[model samples]
Target: MASSSTLSRRSLLKVGGGLGLLAAASQITPAWATGKGTKVSVNSPEQLLSLSAVDLSQAIRGGSVSCSEVMTAYLDQIETYNPTYNAIVSLRDREQLMDEASRADTELQRGQYRGWMHGFPHAVKDLAATKGLKTSLGSPILKDWVPGHDAIFVERLREAGAIIIGKTNTPEFGLGSQTYNSVFGVTRNAYNPDLCAGGSSGGAAVAIATGMVPVADGSDMMGSLRNPAAYNNIIGFRPSQGLVPFGPTKEVFYQQLGYEGPMGRTVQDTAMLLSTMAGYDSRVPLSQKSNPTSFAGNLDTNTQGLKVAWLGDFNGYLATEPGVLDVCEQALKHFNTIGGTVEAVDMKYPMEEVWQTWLTLRHFLIAGIASGLYSKESNRALMKPEAIWEIEGGLELSAMDVYKASKARTSWYHALDKLFDTYDVVALPSAQLFPFSADTHWPKEINGRTMDTYHRWMEVVTPGTLSGCPVANVPAGFDSQGRPMGIQLIGRNKEDLKVLKIAHAYEQAAKLTQTNPTLVKS
Candidate 1:
C-alpha cells in the first residue's frame, strides 16, 4: 500500500502544529489524563478483540460487524482496563472516536471503504504529535501542549481510516526504554503490574497486551519497540532505518540510529500496519522508495532450510539475566525443529565499542533535542536524572568522540555484514533483563553487575538498533515466573520481508501468538 500524501511535515503543520507549552514546574505531573468516553454503549465487541487486524479488517469490509461496533468494543475495554495498567494516557473523549467510527461505518455502507485500518482504533507513541490531542511525550513540560498537526505517520494512519483514539506513554522525549516520564508515571507490564512494561514504547506495548488497543505506533532507537514487545508478549518491528522514515527530524539522511514502525499482537497485524506507515517522501531525504504491498500480502509460511543463528549474549558481551538466554535458546530449537538450521555463532566485533558508539551518538541526539529544556532549571529539573546526565554527557563530548563512535559503528556494521553473509537471521534476547518492578526507576544491577545508568540493562537491543536492520520481536514464551520473553529476529539490511517471513514461520510453527494474557482477578 502507498503511504498517504499527507505524511509530510508540511502536512503535519497544516493539521496540528506543536507549539503550545505549559509553564515550567519542577514537579511535573504525569500525562495520564483520565478523560471519560461517550457513554454510548454497544453490545460487547469483546470477542472481536480476540481477532487479528487482518481478520477484523476483512470483517469490517464484509459487514460482519460495523466499524462502530468494533470501536465500541475497544473503547469499553480501554475504560475497563486502562485504570489498572495506566498504559494509555492523554486519552481523547470516546464520543469523538465513536463519531469517527460511525462515519467510517456509513462510508463502508456506501461502498466508500478506506484501507485495512478503515475503522480500527489506534494511538501513536505519546512522543508523537497528535493534531488535536495533548502530546506531552511523557515530559510534564509539554503537558497540556496540543499539537495543531499530526505526526506524519499518525496522519498516514488517519488517512487509512483509523479512528485516532489517544496517545501512549513514553519516557521523557523517548530517551529511555523504561517508559516513565514526568508527564506519565510508570506503565506496568500486562503479565505483572509490579514489573515494568518496557519503554519508550512501553505504553503502546502494554495497550496491546492488556487489550486496551489492538495496534500502536512506536519508535525504536535503543529497543524502545522490541524490548516492550518482549516484556508484554507481543510483536514489535524496527524497520530498516529509512524504510519507515523518521517523518519529522532535523537530520533525515544520516540519522545514526532510530526508526518509527508498528507494534501489534501478531506479526500479520504488524505487517498490515507497516504497509500503511511506510513509503518514500523526497521531503525526508533518507526515505527509501519501495512498495510495501507485499509485506502483508506475501507472508511466506515456509522456513524450511532458512539459515538461523542464535547469538545469545553477543558471545557473553552483553550482561544478561540467567534465564533470558535460556528462553531465546529454546526459541531457536523451534526453528531447528521446523527444518531451519539454528546454531550458536560467536561475533568477532568489539562489543564494548559498539555499546560506546551507541551511547555517544544516542546521547548526542538526545542532548540536541532536549537542549531547550536544559536552558530552564525548572524544565531541566522536571526531567529524570538520567536524562539530565545524558544531556550533559553529550555536551561534554568532542567532535572527535562522535567521529570515533561513528568509526566504531562502521566496524560494527561491517562485522555484522560478514555475519549476515553466512546467516539469514540472528536471534537474541530483546532485553538483557526480564520485566522488573514497575515502581523501581531502573535495575541498578543485573546478574550481580552494576548497570551504568537507568537504561543500561537494555543493551541487548543495541546491535539491531545500530545496524539499521529490520528487527522483529517474536514471542519466545515465558520465564520461570511467567514473565514473557521474546527472541529478536534480525534479518539482513532492508530485508524486511525476509525477517517477517521467518517470524511468521516461527509463530505458526509454535502456535504461540494464540496465547493471550489473562489479568489476575483482584
Candidate 2:
C-alpha cells in the first residue's frame, strides 16, 4: 500500500489540471460556483464548515462532483479558518491531492470505482507516521522526524482510495487528552475556539468537525479518540483492539488498550472507514483471522429485542454534567421505544485501583517507546518536563508493577464479562461535561471533585478500554451552552459491527446529525 503522504502527493499532481478548471470556473461563473454562494444558508462558521464523509463520498460517486472540487473547497476552508483553530498542523501538497482526485475520477469513468472512501479527503493524527510527512508526535525533540514508511493503518486507508491530506496536531508523545504541544501550539475546539479540541487525537476530530476533512483516522488509548470526538461532536469508533492491526508488538496486555480507529461526522461514515481499516495483518500477531466485513451494511438492523445495560455513572467515578445524563437517558429511552429492553445495572469495581493500574501500564509503555530520548546527556533540554516525568515513572516501575497491573486489568475484564452476559450493550456519557474552553486542559476540578490527573476525569471510558470492547460515540445532544455531548455504546467482545448498527439506529431516530459547529470567520 502506498503511504498516505505519497498518495496525497500523487493525488495533487493528478488533479492539478482539474483544480485549475475549478479556479477558472470561479473566474467565469457566479460566486456559487465556488461553494461560496447561498445554495444553503450557514448559521455559523461551523455549519458552513462541517461536511459529512458519507455525503462527500456520495457526491463524488454520483458524478455531480469531482474529488478535485471537494478537495479545493476544503483547502479553501482550511486556509480561511484553520489559522484560528490550529486544527490542521500541516497541509498536503495541494497539486498532488488534486492529481490523485483526478485519477479517482478517471477510475470512476472507467467503471473501476472503489467503495465509499474513494476520492474522499481525510487526515491522520500526527502521532501516526506517514511517509514523507512530518510525524512529530507533537514533541519538539522530534520536530523534524519523518517516517520511512506509513503506519499499517494508514496503508489500509490508502488502499481504500482515501486521499491523505495531512496530519493533525496532538500532545507531545500523546501523553495527555488535550491537543497542545510546543511543536504545533494547540488545537482549539471548532464549537468554541477558546476551548480545547481534546487530544491526543484532538486535531483529527477538529478537522472533521470544522469541514477541513470528511473523515479522519485517530488512535485511542485512555480516550484519546473518544474524548476528542465527544468534544467536537463527531462520531469516533474504537474497534475491538485486535480487529484493526496495531502492530510491531503483539502483547495483548498493552496493544489491546492502544489501537487506532475512525472518526467522522456521521455513523455510516465512521463505519465505512472502520470497514476499510479492519482486517488481519501478520505483523499484528494478535490480529483476528477473518475477512473484513462491511461495517456500513445492514446498519438499519432492528434493535427491538436487544438488551442494553445503562451504567450511567460507572459506579460514580465519572463526574457528568447536568444535562449530560438527561441527553443520554433520553437516547436510551429510544432503544426501549424500538423494542429494546433498557435497564440500570450496577458496575461495582475499585475505581482508584483501575486508574492506578492504567497509569502504571501506560506510563511504562510510553516511556519504553521514548527510552532513547531520555539519555543522560540529551535529557537536559530535549525532553519536556512531563515527558521526563512519565519516563522516570516508567523507569521506576518494576516487573512486578506491570504484572500487578495486568492482573488488575484481567480482573476488571472478567467483571465486565459477567455484566456483558446479561446485556447486549453498555452505554454511558461519552464525556463528563459539554465542550469546555479549549484554553485549558481537562478541568482539574469538576462538580467540586478534584481530578488528580488528566485521565481521571474520563474514567468512564476505561471499562471499555480495559475490556477491549468495541465502543462508538454517538452524538446525543448539546448542553445549555450549545456545545455537543455524546453517549458511548459498547458492544460485547468482538461484536464490533453490532455496536455500530445500534449507533446507526440511534442516529437515524435522533436526527441529531443536523447539529454542526458554527464556524466564525477570523
Task: Please provide TM-scores, in order, for all candidate models, with all chains considered together.
Answer: 0.90, 0.86
205-315: candidate 1 lDDT, tens digit per residue: 999988877788999989988999999989999998788867566666556587789998888789888988898877687787987665756465545566666667765
After TM-score superposition, the amount by which residue 400's alpha carbon in candidate 1 deviates from its true location, in angstroms, is 2.0
User: How big is the positional error of residue 431 in model 1, measured in Å on the Cα after superposition?
Assistant: 1.1
lDDT of 2 by residue, 319-401 (tens): 76667777677666556545566666656667678778788887788777777778765543866676787777898999999
Model 2, residue 26: what's the lDDT?
A: 14
> In model 2, what lDDT does residue 40 have?
40
Which portions of model 1 miss their true places by more than 4 Å?
A: 1-44, 520-522
Cα RMSD, each candidate: 13.0, 12.3
Residue 127 of model 2, lDDT score? 86
Q: Cα deviation in Å at residue 312, candidate 2?
A: 1.9
